[model samples]
Target chain A: MVDQPLAVAARSLFYRKKRHRDLRQRFIEVLLFLAALSSVLTTIAIMVLLVTESLPLFEKVSIIEFITGRDWAPLFDPPRYGILPLICGTFVTSMVALFVAIPMGTIAAMYLSEFAAPKLREVAKPVLEILAGIPTVVYGYFALLFVTPVLQMLYSPFGEKLSEWLPDIFPYELEGFNMLGPGIVMGIMITPTISSISEDAMRAVPVELREGSYATGATRFQTAWKVVFPAAISGIIASYILGISRAVGETMIVAVAAGLQPTLTLNPLRPAATITTYIVQVSLGDTPHGTIGYQTIFAAGLTLVLLTLFFNVIGYFLSRRFRETY
Target chain B: MQGSLAGVRGNIQRRQLWSAIFAIVGLLVLFIAIIVLLALILQLAIQGVPRLSWAFFTSFPSSKAEEAGILSALVGTALVMLVTAFTAIPIGIASGIYLEEYARKNWIAALIEINVTNLAGVPSIVYGLLAMGLFKSALQLGESVLTAGLTLALLILPVVIVTTREALRAIPSGLREAAYALGASKWQMVWDHILPYASGSILTGIIIGLSRAIGETAPLITIGALTFISFLPPSPFKSDFPFLSFDWVRSPFTVMPIQMFNWVSRPEPEFQLNAAAAGVILVALTLLMNGLAIYLRYRFRKGVKW
Candidate 1:
């Protein structure tokens, strides 16, 4: 008789627990769905805000002029809205940054993935992470205080010597805050990004492939450069694109090291303002929102957003394809 | 016959030399990066270490470099991080759990997955603009710690979500099946099983996300956080019984990066030293967070390996 009562009690308790579980699960699932949806909502908001802010600027400045004109004089007396110089500046610095980033990054990635023993990699990774984790503002100060002065000391003499021969072309007059200093520092800033990504790509190359190359009597370098590089081409390209995207969007380094002069010069030895730096420069002055000055930053941000997003999409797809194989 | 043999030997020797050279070059690349890192640390240490003191942590910033301290900026940064974690952790884990477990293998899930990836790549400043429009202009929250924190929470949302999903995926599905078969609800299974297992990694991700947010300057700048706040935000608690207040949330704020940025731009060399000191503090904070994350990842990884 006691056993019967205990069994009945257990049955009732189980039923009640089941009922509570049902309601909790339903509430939690719906909450999670809303949370997940927020990401998409963020994207939509970014696009909508950029478009609404940028639209007014386009109405003021002709789209063709903004794209095609070789000058960017937003704060001038006449207020020329030509963004070509900013675009040119962005390209010039990014090109310089990539020049340093790609070669060094690829080589480092090769060393890390293919050559370094596991112990060495463990030691090296956190060091590289420290570099990667440095705030951009710190990099800005480094560029301004350290890199610029060093470059000036090393290059100004070369400029004076070269002026004897090629006058205009050889005489690369490096300024205190120029495209070169920030570009090089930015390269150092992003090297870990490229190196790590490419390292991942190289790591993903099956060990079998490397052994196969070794079986063919290939040198370590040859095996890595020829076989593993080809195998991970998609990922390497994606990493390059992402690195470029990051370099393009990088703001504070150029703002502090490369002066806020939007110039159409390809000479990285000279000061040139990138789109990001220009935005920072304007934002520093506190241009009231809704003014053309304020809206210009949003426009620049939109341009930056579009440019980075394009590469991000391409990089994403490329990496995805690579991931799908594994 | 002798000449032909010599030519072949020479070619092989040249290839070996080139291979050796390439390996050296690769090592040199890593060396250069290490050197740069050292130079930056040395630079900060030379200028900043002398100024690290109790006063530096206690006083508000001032025009005089000696009088200036990072107290306001430090408090603001801490509060901002707290807010960011509070907003991001729950929502991000929920989103990640939904995507990983609750959502079906359908287009909606795929869309959310892809969108998260894209959102991760969006520039921080664009998020700032969104915050400016949404929080400042539309909602009339004005420039406050809450606005900056919320902006960063949104910015790091993708990172947290991605990390959470990965952590959850690391768990074996056998546990889930056993729980369900035992008549446990989905929430109960997740609460009792999945979360405990994933909590280490989830915490690691949150720390890393906050570390990144702490160092972030552009978004906060874009949202109109002043570089010159001498007073602290209103206290989060008061003398009265309630002991909780939102006054700090409503007040203007400055963060470490913004304060550092302001100092670095000043004309005086003394201010530059102050900037360096603040930079060191910021760097220490970020490095500590990252180190904790790395340690957690390492410890939990070995323990969880089945």
Candidate 2:
């Protein structure tokens, strides 16, 4: 009877411990689920805040006008709340930045993935990452000081006499602070992003494919250009979209280098404000929270958020479309 | 016919020569990237190093560029980073664990996975906008260090989560199976075996994310963190009876990047030099964080076989 009691006690203890562990596991699982859910919540919050704050602006101002009209002077006596100038600025600078980044980044990726020795690759990767790690503000400084000065030297002469040769096509003088300066610096800042991602995509191309090209009497250049390039095109396009998204959302470089003057212009060598820089410009001054000036920035923020999201979604789909190939 | 064969052989040799030439050209292209990086460093160093006096680190920002210092901004940055790390690390690692370990291949798990990846690429300024509306206006936190820190936490959370998932994914599934066979529960298996193994790289990810936060300016600006603060917030540690204080969290603050940005905008040459000096300090801080992360990752790679 005593032996029976002792055995029962030991059995009960085991059951209790098992129950405790199961309960603890459930508790931790809940905690982790909440943690993971927080990220989804963050995205929802962003969309919600942007929509709520910007709805007021769209309600007061015509959405079509906001999208298509010419000026961005929300604080003027008459208040022209047109965002076309900001859109033009965003597009002009991003296109220019992409122009510099795409070719340079792709070439660097080709060298890194196909040509460089392993030792060289190792040494070079951190250097490029360091380039990537540099604060955009530093690039902004570089844009204003070094790049603007150099551009002044090279373009100053042409800028002065350009009207004589290409009337209505060129500015008579390019300001020290202009779209080209920030656009070029932004390109350099994003180069590492493009190169690293492209290198990954190119590296994923199978060794058999490269070897097969060589077996067919293809030169190294021929194999890289004809075979590998086509195979990696999807990945390349995805990275390009991501790069363009970066250029679009970049704030510091453009805000610091390009003068925060919201003007509608096609010229790259002119001071213009992008959507991101406009937000910074307003925040720099003391616009009361409830005022039209303050709310206009939210409208701008919504535009920027939507624009970048569109690019992000596109890049995501492009990468997914080609993933099965790998 | 022999002469034709000789011609074909000579063509092969010439093709090989040109292939070698193409490779050399590729190297030359890479050199251009290097030149860009070097030029940035050379310019910053030339402008900044000359202005790195003791006063630059000690004094508060002044109207006169000659007397301006980054002391208050540096303190604000450190304070913000501490709060950011405290909030981001736990949530990120927990989510990483959940996604990689606990969750089944169901829709919810996939949703969080996609959400994290998307959030990582969502521009940092968007995070700021969200923080502005939600934290500053709705919750009424205003432009305090607390709000900035929390905003930064959200900004870097995706980075932390993605990197943490990567680190945990590297741990062999065999380890999980081994723990399960030992009668360990799923959470127990994760806490005991997986976490300890992946901690090094998890730490590396956190450090890297924090480094990015330190250099970020756009979001903080949107939240209305001041560009000029002459005095430091009350110390995080109290000099009086209650030893540790969070009064600093609610205080007005400016960070190094904002201070640097403000000075860089001034028309004076002196302000440009001050901005460069501040830039050097900010870069040094980021590089230190990154170097630590790199070192930790190296150690982790060396220590782990799989």
Candidate 3:
């Protein structure tokens, strides 16, 4: 009878331990839920704050004027909040980035998936990602010191040719800091992002498809172009859209390489200010908090956010519409 | 029949030739990408080697800004990074586990997954505002290291969560079933079996997250980390150390990016050179962390790939 009582006590203790563990798990679950929810909540709050603060900007500067007006004298006594100059600059750089990133990224992904041997694939993928690993600040330095100098050197020989050609072919002054420098650097920055994703997408295509084409004696190029790439098109486009989102959001490189003068010009060679560059400029210069100058940055930030968000939506849609393999 | 066979052979030759051309073009793209990276490395190494000094590593920021070294910035960066990792890793891993192994496939779980994806894509500067509003002003943490670290934690949380989930998913179902058949409890199986299998992957994810957090500049600037700080942080809890201690919530500290940015924007030649030096440091740290993550990922793939 004494032994039975001790056994019962031990059984009760075990049950209590289970209950305690269950409670602790529930607590952990709640905390995880809260942490995840906080991210969403934080995003919502930022949107609200941006909208509320940006309202004054819209009120002061009409949407059309903000979007289309060419002058960028926001710091003058009578501030000009014509945002088009910045928008144009941002677009020019982003478009140039796309031009450089897309063909190269897609081609590299195709090569890695369809052409490279297994060992080479393993080596090349990580080497390509080194571009992603390099900090944006370094890319900025490369653009300013190396790329700018190289461009200047290349142009120096063409100076007389350009001077001869200016009236007929060129209509603007040549500047050291221009879209060509930053666009090329930004392209390099975005290349790895596109390649990594596109490579994944290409790899997702069933080997059977490639085998089918090869069985028909289709050349590897024909098999890749007519069969594999088309099948991988959706993923490839999604990768390109992702690259665009990255290009739009890039800050440091553009701020450094693209001079922060919001000029209204279509010329890629002339100095211009991107939206990110503008934010960097306004934030760094002497601008008191709660002032219109500070508010301008928020407005500019809102534009950048909305533009990127729109691209993200497009990217998500493309991924859903085009996703072939799981 | 002989003539037809000859034609067929010619067609095969043409196809092989085209494949060769495509292969060459692909290799060319790879070459260009690699060359750009090599160029960046060489440029940084050549410019930054001379600036690498004991004084550069140990001295504080100077009033003659061009003369300033990066000691305090490095310390402040380390403190912020350590604190951010401490806060973010546990929560991120747990949530990842829950989503991967535990959570029911319900609407709520699906919503959580979507939210995390969108959060990953959200620009980082938004997180800075969140820190400014939630940690800095509302919670009264102020523009200090702690707040900045917390803010960065939030920014990197989605990345960590996604990566950790992928890692957990890679653990085979047989392991789970075997543990359960042996009468191991759910928590016991996860703690003992699943986590060990997933640890390499999880570590890789965390390191990648750390790299992203360290390079982040926008949120730190938004949350009020100073562009300059002369003194090193005393401790994690020192209020005077900005984000380090709870005691000095209002003090300012400069991070590597902001400091480099300040120098780069200056018109002085010396500052520009120093910016190059700082860029080298920042790039080195980022690349090292990323290399570790990539290596870990390769290990995971090699060990686990079917």
Candidate 4:
């Protein structure tokens, strides 16, 4: 009977300790759950902040005018609130960036994933990563000081000569703060992003597929371009979308190099204000709260968010689809 | 048969020539990217190296370009990073742990995953707007160090969480099974086994995230970081009782990039030199951090067998 009581007491003590551990486990789990939830909360917070702040501005100015109007002057008497010019600037620069990035990024990805020796790949990968790691602000500095001067020098004479032949298209010369310099620099900034992701997608293709192509007596380039590229098309497209989203959302490069004049021009040689540059210009000034000037940023922000969100969602889904396919 | 063989040989030769051309083109593109990086560093060094001096580190902004220093900006960046590191590290690690360990394959986990991926794609400037509305206006934090720190923390949270989860996932499953076999609870298994094994990689992720955060000028600019601040915030130390103080977090700040921006935008050529000098320091700091992270990752990868 004494042995039975001792056994029961020891068992009860063990159970109590286990119970305490269980309670602590639950508490810690809950804390972690809340931590994970915070990201969703941040998304919610951003949405709520943008919508609530933008509603007041929308009430004063119609959404159609904000999206479709060509003028963006909100500080002057009878201030206009058209955002089309900013959109045009964003589009032109991003298009220029894409023109440079796509070919360079794709070729680089092909070389890295298909042709480069393992030793060379190891060295090159980190160098590319370092390119991505360099600050956009430095790129901005390069765009304004170095790239612009070079472009102006190269284009000044060329534009002059070309205008003699085609006055309509080549009338304007490259300005000090034109879209081309920042656009080209932004292309350089975004190349690593596109190449790295596309390389990953290419690398994920089955090795047997490459071997099969080689067995057919195909050259490395032929196999890479015909087989691997097609196989990784979805992922490559995803990278392009992501790169486009990044270029659209890029701020400092345009703000520092591309002038803040909101001109609706397709000319890469002209200076214009992008949506991001406009936001930066306005934010740099002291526009009092609740005023149309201050709220304009929120309106601009909402547009930026929606535009990026559209691309990001597509890119995310396409990337996920690619992962599933392979 | 001889003619057909000749045609086949010619076709193969053409294919080989095209392949050779593409290989050279690809190599050229790769070199161009590398050359761009080298050129940036070279340009910054040539322009900024002459401006680096003992006086440059201790002085504040002045009307004369030669008289200005980065003391206030440096202090501001350090304090803001301090705040960002403390706030981001714990929360990011915890969230990563939760998603990797505890969460079931359900809607909540799916939602959080999607949110993180999308947030990573959101532009940095938008984060600044969020901070302006939520922190500066709604919470009345104004344009203070705390507000800037919090904004960056939110911005980098997704990076940290993604890296932590990746590190945790890389730990061999045998370790988890062994812990469970030892009658350890789930939390104990993670704490005792998974985390220690993944610490090196997690730390590397933290450094990289911080390095990116350090170079960020857009979000801070959007949050209304000052272009010129002649004085430093209150120090976080005191000689009296309770020697620690957080009064500095509420103080207005100007970071290195913002200072560089202010100088870069100036009309004078002298200010451009000052901006270039600041750029050198900023780039050096970011490169140092990223280099350290890369080295740590390489070392840990080589050291850990499993």
CA lDDT of every candidate: 0.86, 0.87, 0.80, 0.91
Give the TM-score of each candidate: 0.94, 0.95, 0.92, 0.97
Fraction of true contacts retained by every candidate, in order, equals 0.65, 0.70, 0.43, 0.74
Quick one: ranking by TM-score, best first?
Answer: 4, 2, 1, 3
Candidate 3 CA-lDDT value: 0.80
Q: Look at candidate 1 and tell me the lDDT of residue A237.
A: 83
lDDT of 1 at A262: 84
Ten residues in sequence with the least summed lDDT for candidate 2 chain A: A156-165
Candidate 1 DockQ, CA atoms? 0.68
Off-target runs (Cα >4 Å) in candidate 3 are A1-17, A62-65, A158-161, A164-166, A286-289, B1-12, B63-66, B236-250, B303-306
How much is the TM-score of the A chain of model 3? 0.92
TM-score, cand. 4: 0.97
Q: Tell me, by TM-score, which candidate is best.
A: 4
The prediction achieving the highest lDDT against the true structure is 4
Candidate 1 lDDT over A269-315, as tens digits, reads: 88888888787777777666688877888888888998997887777
- lDDT of model 3 at position B89: 94
Which order, best to worst by lDDT?
4, 2, 1, 3
Show where candidate 1 strays beyond 4 Å.
A1-19, A157-169, A313-326, B1-13
On DockQ, the leading prediction is 4
CAPRI-style grade of the A/B interface in model 4: high
CA shift of B16, model 2, Å: 4.3
- Residue A206 in candidate 2 has what lDDT? 90
lDDT of 3 by residue, B4-91 (tens): 9888898788788988988999999999999998898888778776777888888776757446799877877887887789888987
Model 4, residue B266: C-alpha shift (Å)? 1.0
- Candidate 1 vs 2: which has more TM-score: 2
